[model samples]
Target: MISKTTIDNVFDTARVEEVIGDFVQLKKSGSNFKGLSPFTDERTPSFMVSPVKQIWKDFSSGKGGNVVAFLMEHEHFTYPEAIKYLAKKYGIEIEETQQTDEQKKQANERESLYLVSEFAKEYFKHVLFKTEEGKAIGLSYFKERGFTEQTIKKFDLGFSPDSWDAFTNHAIKKRYKLDYLEKTGLTIVKDDTSTGTATKMFDRFKGRVMFPIRSMSGRTLGFGGRILTNDKKAAKYLNSPESDIYHKSKVLYGIYHAKQSIAKEDNCYLVEGYTDVIQFHQTGIENVVSSSGTALTPEQIRLVNRLTQNITVLFDGDAAGLRASLRGVDLILEQGMNVKICTFPEGEDPDSFSRKNSLEELKSYLEEKSQDFISFKASLLASEAKDDPIKKADTIRDMVVSISKIPDVIKQEVYIKECARIMDISEAVLFNTLAQLLQKEQRDASRKKRSEKKTMEVVASEKKPVEKVDAQYELERKIIELLLLYGPKEEDFEELILETDEKGEIDFKPETQTKTVFRKIYLDLQEDEIEFTNDAFKELYTAITDRFMREEDLKVDDFVKVLEPEKAHAVTDILMEEEKYSLHNWERKEIYVKEKKHSVSQIVSETILNLRRELINQKIKELSETIKQQGPDDEQVNLQDVVDYITLKKLLSEKLRRVV
Candidate 1:
């Protein structure tokens, strides 16, 4: 475990904006910073970071938390990993206490998998550098491809020997389990049918140069191995099988290294192979990632979308390759991102083209040749159409399908005009085509919604239970907000005790006293034995009251660290929400707004009274239901129950007017 003092130092030194700004492009928005949401695709900036509070909120995706929480969510890091990452980034030394044997033995499955993957990565790299076979075969192959030793080591490129048991034995000797080894697809096992008792076990990527595929956070999720020798019966390139950590469709090669550069440039360069990405980086173009030879997925697109709105795809002159990637272009468009295509020279792919040209020449070629996807697709299809009117019309429809995927209407309109000119069609014709496509999609969606709704209505009638949403949900939220915002402040509170006078009027006595907001709320709730009805509210109430009992200063950063992700997000939502309205700067227009702090006492009191009234109403509802389902002698209703319900309702109404 990391010592508390070290964690505090990390938190104090690592600025939230600086950490998040590495992955996102944030523009200053008044007192805070705003950026496109890393959690979702959005045109306008909705992800806000507050340096004052050390928290961030993505209104688009409803995710919010402090710096450590952001790292955990964005990188899929364990708590300790997140802390370590921050400590390393800000150069804070971490102090870890020694764990007992039992504590050490408690490593969970995911952590074990992570450890095994990491071990495999380092072991493969060691073999490529140290052993005789690795240097002669693996290092020779990389050098032959014009990759310098620095490039090879930077990407952690490695060689797996042909001897099948070499890696398997080495791993097992290190106490790594065969279960995780096989689970990660690093080792293969085959049944020994002749013996009928034991199985054959060996390495999965023997005689192949290894490319470890990593997640955005630099965790090795899997590997892509290219065979060194050409064997007709064997596959040329093989990848790790699907596991909990490695999903190829979602994992883009070089993303871990390229994310910062992509954000820095505000544009991402997309390629198709591991070498292509490494080659681009070697050639001084750092903002490049590969889809690892798979068709683009929404998840993969979203990974780049977090860093930039613009994507430039590098394609060879091969018509087949371009055709194969057309669907990927459509996926990018569907994500509401700007995509361009830059074709390399006639006989060269990104790998070879990059290796052949100087950095300036390659960058100049890209600038001269890049085209918006609309222009690229239309021109490519138009050339293929070749003055054939029917093919030209079909080509326009295909272009319309691509254009319809764009989410921004203005961009769609611009693309439509460009397509019309390229296809020699009227602008009105393309507009109609786009409208038809959108209508058909919406109609299909409506049909699905209706069918799902019909089934849901039946299921809901028969199986769904009452929601039991506390009528005081908003009140409870307000109370929590008050507790979080003003709980440390000492303020005067007036306690009212109401009694009926001899003249049948209400008499009130007020006792004025001062207490901390936390103390006042704790005592008030305790006096009435009132608990928040919502589970989250109830949990938050307990956490706050318990924390305040032993501490005077309520540090939100410290408090949020102890909470679960969901509860931490909730607390940040309350803390960060009100500051956003102020960002618009309405006060500059000479419109004054009242400060909420001045009314804190009244807001807190009214919320508590409303909550108590709601609880009473819930009881009254129970009593009325009891009467409705009662003795056969009075099936219609019971007189005593009716009188009790009416009396409770009247008392609740009186309490609603003024709290006692």
Candidate 2:
């Protein structure tokens, strides 16, 4: 269990912008910074970070959160893990009391997988440098590939011994369970049918050079292994099979290293393998990644899209594989990204080419060869067509299909015109073909979705209806915005109240001051048991209450920083949604009343004060009823006097203009 003091300390020290900046590259956009949405596929940046409020919101995906929340959402880290990550980054020491074995056992499965992966990484690193066989084989292989010591360490290149039981034995010695090892696909399990015997095993990446595949946040999700020996039977490269923690389609190799550079340059250089990324990055072209030798997937494209919309694909000109890879160009365009292709000279791939050139020379070579996908494809197809009308029509249809895949109408129109110019065809003809393709695809997709829905209906008999999301959140958001902006100050206003007790008496009471009234209204809200319906609003409310109860101070700037990212974003969005209207100097803004002028701030304070006063009076009346039921106790009367005097003093203070 972590103490409240520790949690408070974590909140006090962690800055939302600073923490999120580690993973997201944000450039200044007005009062806030904007970056590609980390949660969605986007061509233009819609992820907004407000430094003033220390919160971020991705308008594209509606995923916003404080720093801790970002880690929780993006990296799948728990609250404690996020706090620990921030503490480590900022060099703050953490103090923990203790945890039971059961509590430790209850830790999430994904986190345990992460822990296992992290442990394996360290073990492999140790084996590579510390063990004689690992040093001779793994270290030599990497060095022979022209990898520097720094590069080898940066990528955590490692070796697993030829012995089948080497990793399994070591893991067991560490008291790590084989169940998780098998679950993560790090170990293979076998059950003998004849003998009715069962045995767990490890075979996924045995006896190979290990390449760790990391997620966007730099945590190892899986491993890729390359066999050095010329084994005719076994495959050259083997990757970890799909597991709970790793999905090949959803991940891209080298993303963790290249994310910042991609955002900085607003472009990602795509290649085709693990070595390509390493070699390119070593050559100081840091904004490069690979599809890890898989077919280009939309999910992979989206990963790159989150960092940049401009992609330059590097290919080996001599290889037939280059022609085969051209399909990915359309995939890139389909995601509404700017696609450029740059092929190396005959007989050189990105790996060899990068190794042979200096950083400046490589950059210059790429600059000179880079061409947009449209021109490159048209010119390439033109040669294949050889002025044959039939082949040319086919080529035009292919281009039209690519154009149809673009989600943005404006981009689609622009691309159609460019394609027509390049193909020397009429824009109308190309548009007609594109429209046909788009319609076909939409109908096919709808049919497929309906078919899948039928299967789901059979498996799940019923579905839960979405509950109506209350709009009271809007009101709470407005109130929080006002509190954050003007909680410290006071304002004057008028109020209406019954002058007499339950017996019908008349009395004089003063209007509530703005700050005081806000507080009173805020407390009355608690008494009335009204709750914020928005999840983010609820989070913000809890944070506000925590701060208010602890410090007795409400600094909007400070409180927003303490909230989760989503809540912080909700607060910030509301605060900035309205246009700035100024009452020049001391000209007060008015609120509508019974055909009379009322200052806006004064009305707010008065409303709060009146609500709180009404609540107190209600409580006093209940006590009076109880007193009438029995003989009056001196203690009860004393408490009543205290309440009455406090209310009278509040009214008098408002009348004398002493508070507001």
Candidate 3:
């Protein structure tokens, strides 16, 4: 368990914008920051972070909370894990009590998997530096690759022993569960009937050097291991199988280290392999990442997209590889990111090229050689299509198809003009082809939507009845929102007093009283014996009221940190509900909007009166039902009670200025 002091220190030191900015690109918007929703696939910014309140809200997903909550939501971290991450990020020393064996064993499955992966990383590093075989093999290989000790350590480069069950045996001795070991793909387990054992276990990456693949927050999700010796039957590289923590398509190697630099530079250098990223970083190019030898995935593209709108793909001299990578450019363009293509000399790749040049030389080469993706693609294909009319026509259509993938019409036009210039083709012809492709795409999308709608209609026939809005629940929610926003605020309220006028009609006389907002709300609810119908709202009401009563200084940020996750989520939702209106910039158009603070008293009184009326109506409904079901003796009493409740509701309604 992390000490409370450490957690508080972390919260105090960590800024919500700075923490979330590592995962999502945030641009300044007035007093807050807005960015594309990292939790959802969004084109426009819908994620808002308020520095003044120290809270964040994702209107797209409806997830909002403080810094700890963002990490828990985004990174799937536990409370302690989120705290530790913040403490580490801010360079705060953590104070934690050691957990007993039973406590450690009770951790959730995902956290256990993460723990195992982290343990494996540390174990592999110990093997690389401390063991003899590792020094002779894994250490030598990395050293020969022109990696310095610091670079190797910075990337957490390590080695697995050559023996099959070496790591498996050691992990078991350390009390690591074999289930997690097999699940993480660290140890391959199989039935062993001939050996007279239930199962056989062996290290998956045995005889290989280890490269820990990390999330953007630097959690060890898994590893990518490289086999050293020549084994014709074996693959050169092996990655951790998809598990609870590691999903290769959604991960990019070196992103944890490159994210800051990528955002700072406004560009990301994407390469093909792990070594390529390491070499670039070691060469003073910090804003670079790798695809880990897999084909580019949209998820991987979006990972970089969160940091920058530009990507420069580094390619080797292998023409086949370069051709294979062109499809990724279209993927990047589809995500609305600008892409540039750079290739090394005929005999070199990024790894080899960087090793052969100084930092200045590498920087100069990249700057001089990098070309806009369209120009590079056109030039390369034009050369291949030389003197072949059919190939040249196909190439032009191919470029048109790639251009059609771009989301921006202006960018599409720009690329089409550039393609025409490179291929010596007519701009009108390229535009016509693009238009046809786009039209077909739209038609296909429309057809899909119609088919989906038909299926949904069938499903809708059997769907559950729609839920009607609960007026009482809304009133309860409004009460909670008011308490969370203005709980500690003192204001004068016009309390409605019921009386019989001289003409024998019910009248509502306003009685003025000054009290704290929370006290006024609490007294009214207590007087009526009202309870929140919704469980979440009821819990939050108790928590907020208790805090307001007990603490003289009620800081929403500090108060929220102590609530349970569900209540904390509700508080942020209620507190930041009105912030959505600010996103429209209503004031920028010279239209002034009324501030809620100016009418807090009226809002509070109306809310309480509305609740009273709703509850009275509910009672009258019960009395009416009882009158129909009961004998004549009870009917008159129930009828009179209903009349009295109706009279009171009318007085409350008049106070609210609502028609009966």
Candidate 4:
């Protein structure tokens, strides 16, 4: 467990803007910094970071939190990992007690895989440059592919030695496990069929040039190896098999390297191969990633969704394989991404195109050739559909379906108009087609959910009952909000109790000026222990306690901008909710003083009622526990006493009933 002092230190030292600015390119916007949303695909900047508040909010995605939460979301760092990252960045020393071996061994599985893969990556790079065979073959291949020494190292380009156990031997010598090697598909195990005895395990990518595949955080997840020799039996390219850590659907090649650039440029240049990503990146187009020669998944598109909305897909102009490759464009649209297609001349892919041209020329050519999906599709299908009604109808349907995949209604409408202009079809016809498709898609999705619910019902019936949430929490939250927002107001009205100092006189003083009553009770409450039911409240309570400790003033407006937007808005809603009747200055007529509203009165009454109810409920719980401890034999209930307890309970319940 992290010490409270250390956690406070982490917050104190790590500026929210400084930490967030590392990942997001924030430009000054009033008292805050604004950037393109890191959690959504947006051309316009909607992500706001307030350094003064020490918080951030993504208006597009509605994710708002503190700096630590930002790192946890954007970098996918665990809380501890994010803390460590910030600590390193801010030069904070973390002093802590050591964990047990079992705790240490329970490292995050994703992190463990990354560590192993990183080791393998380094090992492969070592072999490529340090060893004799590696230097001759791997080095020569990369050099021939127009990769510089810097680029080779940048991509972790390497060679696997031809010897079967070369990598296995090195990994074992380094104390890595064979099970992990097999699990990650880095090594293959062989067994004798006759004797059922293990023969030997060897490297999976033997005699191949290695391209390390990485997750968004620049951690190596797996490897994609290319075979140099064109053997009839061996596959040309072999990828690490799907493992517990690497999901092909979610991982995009070069995302780790390109993420910042993509975010900075507000565009991602998506290609089709590992080499293409490397080549473009090497040529100074850092905002480039590949689909890794696999069909694009919605998950892959969503990975890009985090950084930017504009995706320019690069492909060859040749039509032979273009149709199949274009399938992903619709998926990109489904994610509300801005889809643009750019195709190179005959016999050229992005890899070849980039290599042949200077960085400036390549960049300019891409900008020039890039066309909207509607324009590109119209051009691609026009020749085939020339003068054929049935084929043209089919082509029009395909285009409409692709356009329908666009998530934004406004974008879809815009596309409909563009398609009508380009294809000479009525906008109404296309819009009608789109409506049908969307309805059908929604129906299919609903049916799938229904089927899933049936499966869940059977599974849930066999499981233990889930705990019911406490019903008083809402009331507790409301009371806490009132205390945090209005407690310190000097002239604000507050409930109080007054008693005459005579022998047997006690008086219930219903209401008084807030300052006197609150100052006394608030101080008293501070002397006693108080715990909030949730983290947000706990943080707020801590903030309040700090103020009280320092004899500092507290105000709703002072804390409003100090909290993250969601929390601030929550606080704001509570503080300002129906507190007073509206007054117009124009109609004031040198206005006489109007009596103050009963907002605080209602809040106080309800709070006191809820408090009494909570106290009674707590007493009941204690009595129940005591009865259980005493056992049924020892606790012989008195019917009359039970009736009296029930009567008081009903009175307390009646008070609570007035609150909700």
Give per-residue CA lDDT, model 4, range 506-531, as digits (tens): 33344545453245435534543434
Q: Which candidate, 3 or 4, has the higher TM-score?
A: 3
Q: Write the per-residue lDDT of candidate 1 for residues 56-107, one digit (tens) a residue.
A: 9988787899888898888778888889988988888989988676764587
CA shift of 627, model 3, Å: 0.8
Candidate 1, run of 10 with poorest lDDT: 635-644
Q: Write the per-residue lDDT of candidate 3 for residues 192-282, one digit (tens) a residue.
A: 8788764789999999999999999999999999999899898999999999999999999999999999999999999989999999899
Error of 2 at 534 (Å): 12
Better of 2 and 4 by TM-score: 2
Query: Over the stretch 238-352, how does candidate 2's per-residue lDDT look in tens digits?
Result: 8888888899988889998998889788899999889999999899998998888898998899888766779999888685766578889888887888899998988999999
Give me the overall lDDT of model 4.
Answer: 0.75
The alpha-carbon lDDT assigned to residue 657 of candidate 2 equals 55
TM-score of every candidate: 0.87, 0.78, 0.96, 0.76
Clashing pairs in 4: 492-514
Better of 3 and 4 by lDDT: 3
At residue 270, what lDDT does model 2 achieve? 93
How many backbone overlaps does candidate 4 show? 1
Give residue 116's error in model 2 in angstroms: 1.1
Worst 10 residues of 2 by lDDT: 578-587
| lDDT value, candidate 1, whole model | 0.85
Which scores better on lDDT, 2 or 3?
Answer: 3
